[model samples]
Target: MASSKDAYRRKINQNSDLGVMRHQVVSLSFIATPFWRKNGIGQRSPATCRFPKVLGTTKGVKRGLVLPLVATSSQEARSGVNASELPNRGADRLREAVTAREAAFLAVEQSLMQNATTSDVEGTNASTDSKMSRDSPNASHLSQKFLLSYLALWSEARKPSRAEYALAKIISFNAVRQRMLFDYVLQTNVLREREAMDSVPRRIKSDNLRLSVSQRALLHTALAQYAFMERVPVHTIVFSTVELAKTYYGQRFASFVNAILRNLARYGEKWMPELERRRPAEYIVRPLPFPEDNLNVRYSYPGVFVAKVANQLMNQERVVAFLEAGNLTPQIFFRIPCQFTDTAELRAALEIGLLVPWDGSRLSESAARPWNIYRVDLNCADVDGAGDLVIAANTDRVEWAHALPDTSAKDLFQKLLQKFIVQNVTQAEHIYDLCEQLRARWNQRRRLERVLDLCTAPGGKLTAVFEYLQKSGLGDLLTEYVGVDLNGQRLQMVHENIHKAPGMSKGRVFVGIGRGESFVEYQSGFVVQNADDRSIVPSFDLVIADVPCTNSGVLNRRPEARWRLSERDFATAIPRLISLQTSLLTRALRLSRHAVFYMTCSILEAEGSGLVRSVLEQFPEFELSWERLTYTDTAGRDGGYAALLWRHQEN
Candidate 1:
């Protein structure tokens, strides 16, 4: 036991990027030229050049520490370097001598602006600063700056226009994904600046000017680019951010934003050197800040969610990897229908099948064919503005749709069957194989005709069942695929997905708007409609009750989920979701004659294993035939749980 414990300890101490930050900001340095070629490095991009080093090096040292530009000498220096002047190069040698002076100037400027700007952030002691009296009634136009707006979070619950929503994801997804890290960096930096002020020393107080929501949103997006998006030109980041602040707020707020971004460019670089290595517009999936981080802060996941993973796994390394995996945006998964055996399929199949060894199936031989599932290469997968597919997103769960691709185009997917977020598609693939195996077994004695999806809105799983039934030549065996969902708008997705598949259109499917926990009326209608056979009918042969979850396991797919969940008192939700899940599962079990597939896209024990365990203990009639609670360590996959509850029958 001692040796076993020691071995586990050794695994935790593995050489994972777990520890304090690597780079440290020694001090600010004055440089002749702007970092981004006064703007852009043109051909010499960030990919080939090391960051801060690309900016400029002095005394054999790399200095990324920054201060806002306020000069013609800097401009002359930049133009000179761009033109390759020896005199400008000579001036660059004096960077060390002017470092102290630049640092002092920055401190003085900040101290002068400290009292006025401290309140522009979330957490700061601004009570020490006195408030100005109300503006004169004649100057009411000044109040327009207070009207603030932020980028709306895209969710599965909301139905947004495809084009407009696509724009939102491009603007806000990564920024929101790294909200915690950037916010923490800003909050801490704000505190330090407040302390530098000649103000009260403790017990955090605030009454200073607060950042409008729009300003904060703009700031976060800017910081995400400035700090995390390494390949973005520094000039673009700073100029755009400053202008955004100016347009939304007054000129004062613009100055505040300029200063904050400048400090972060220097400070955040050292605080998060990991950004130096990441690709442009890409996300960070490794342990952030390098060396180490708390599970929640490290991945920007909620603390409750992290605690759940920690408690469930009881292994630090597994927990870290699982969290990291959640941040990995898998290459887009394109579900290609089996019937589309075009020239595109013949060519694209070999490439896709080789890239992904999904379910141990890939086309090495010319005789081999592609399955319905294929991961799309976005680079190769081009969308013409003239094309039908207006690409919604590359990473987000809510936008896993291409505006119904051009049917005429002879692309890889050949009119594309469907697009699903990695987690959803992964779950569907596993469930599809499981249900297929069950159907084969059940077919020996009975047809196993009826199926029920208890909560099937935006039906990915139900559609997978359709694919299985049609492809396996078992379309006739299943009579009814009943779908019950509360949301009418989302239930329409089920109809669309079903219609997309060949031979599985309106014939065998029945959908109704109703609650999952108490949907006996819908089941009754289906059974009565099919009472002609009278084969000792149960409401459904297979019941799918994939209940609602916190979605802790797929944080990368749904960047907004954690923040929204945090706001909804997630701590109290445990008992509530469990109760809801239990009732839904109970309804599913009662409705199923043969098997009830209970699933949740969650890693928490209570939601998955523990809940299943209790269900079995109470209802011994249903045995656990197959069950799995998986945590993803590898990238491009997601964590989730599934349990098959089957009623044992004697031969």
Candidate 2:
């Protein structure tokens, strides 16, 4: 029912309304926008603006030009408006203004330097000065002085160690604060090889030509005199000498080194790659058959052996993609202590680029204020694209559970159990049930006689055991609490913490520093030894043998372990496990009434049941007490841990 002209008018009004609303919203952002976004923003003026107060107050101001009433009265009234409307141009200009003292000092220095130097400054000219200068006596002398002074400075900057230049080049490249060119040189390894060649001693061989020679030259002829005179590689020495000569002397000196090096490279068959080309038969046109199934270039291992384990443990595709992603490129993270005036101020000053939250679980800012500000850590990673995995990297361990490929599910789950333990007490009963077969013995044994803690050093488990004993009031009942370790330093920890918490029975806690075989003399007390070591000790009663095996349980704990582990390691560990069991059982039968061998490794028959089988075969006196332990009865377990109790009856 609407007329065409009326519809057009409505459309125009709608568009005008939209335009006014859009402009109003955008206008709100102009004056109050963030300072960082203020760059390139143009100045805006109100329509029909009044003249400024300076112009209005002028004595010759025209009546028509100025606002109504008295010009003075309007000027006074419009002062606030003028002040508010004025550009903040002078605000930024204040930051650039140089102090009077500084300008005066710089003026004096400029005049003195220009007059005092004959042609050029001491450290300003030479190869770095790409600008061409007029040739004159004074200019040439000044250039020579500058070169000498610059070279002296360069020489002084060299590190003290002989190979320090090479090492420093690498270290400085890796350092976050260093120049990008240093990183490029390090990546190329140009300086590394140069330093190596420059380290050798030299002797003058040709007195007439005055060619300096190294010991290697004694084995070659005089044709190699110029090249063999120095320990440096012929090509490197020639190229470097030529480059330096061109910088200082002229192109002719560089040409001299080049011609000599070409001859040396031709004759130096012992050092350089051969460049001879033999002609093939011109008429031959027979096709060579290529085997389709041949693995001529396939089936070889990827990267290093250790890297293989890491790849297997981590989600390789996701990790690779994540590393390539700019988002994950080692973000800069800092652990700032709470000492600065405000954490925000310090963070602002220190933050040069993007910052990310720390990944470690243990990264907690201390409640202690000022000290906390100073004690923060800083880290950096670059961000790539969205396809890469967002790694929860705390130190070296990067866990990307969701990022792993579908094919890697089995390995992924297996490693997950190894990395985390059930901290919840409600979950512990189910976890404990899956760990050991001898449920009856664990339930019946109201009192524990002797406890063995194998692999007890670096004791997360040790602390738990001590706490368990303390809570149960079983610490007093423990006659001999033995902690075994191979590391001398870790043994020191066992010695210290065991005495402090849940004090063991008087004179019963024994700390063994050496390998398990070192305790072969004793049939009882406590013994700590590596499983592969010689088994000389007597049998134990309650053996707490936390045997060493493929650490598949802790893939998350050791990211590198996944790539390092192989079928060969699994195969190799079986025999070692048997040997360890033989050693421990031999000692256990003589010492304890029963043994409890605990391990973080899976309860695969190879390590747990397989070794138990070998122990039963060798010692007929011992029996697998089904009533005391019940580990194997359950199916489809989470941790894949199993326990078996071996009792040596009185024969």
Q: How many clashing residue pairs, candidate 2?
A: 63
State the lDDT of candidate 2 residue by residue for 1-651, as single tens digits.
977545654554476532222222211100111111122334332232222232233344323222211111221121112433312211222122132111111122122222222222112221112111111012123223222122122223331221222211111111211111111211121121112211121211110111111100110111121211222234543454344333322343234335434433433432232212110111101111111122110111112322433343366443332211211111111222223225444444335322323232121321211111121111111111111222122121122222322333333323322322212121122223322333234434454555655446544344444444443443444455666665554455555444434334244666665444234432354343433334534344355544544333322121122222334444453345445545654444444455454443432345455566676686676675531111211111112233445565431
Clashes per prediction? 6, 63
TM per candidate? 0.61, 0.32
Residue 643's C-alpha lDDT in candidate 1?
80
TM-score, cand. 2: 0.32
Candidate 2 runs further than 4 Å off: 1-439, 442-446, 469-478, 496-507, 521-540, 567-590, 600-604, 623-640, 648-651
| RMSD versus native structure for model 1 | 19.5
Summing lDDT over every window of 10 consecutive residues in candidate 1, give the lowest-scoring window.
125-134
Residue 300 error for model 1, in Å?
1.1
**lDDT string, candidate 1, 39-100, tens digits:** 23353532253222212333322233221122122322222233234223222322222211
Residue 505: error of model 1 in Å? 2.3
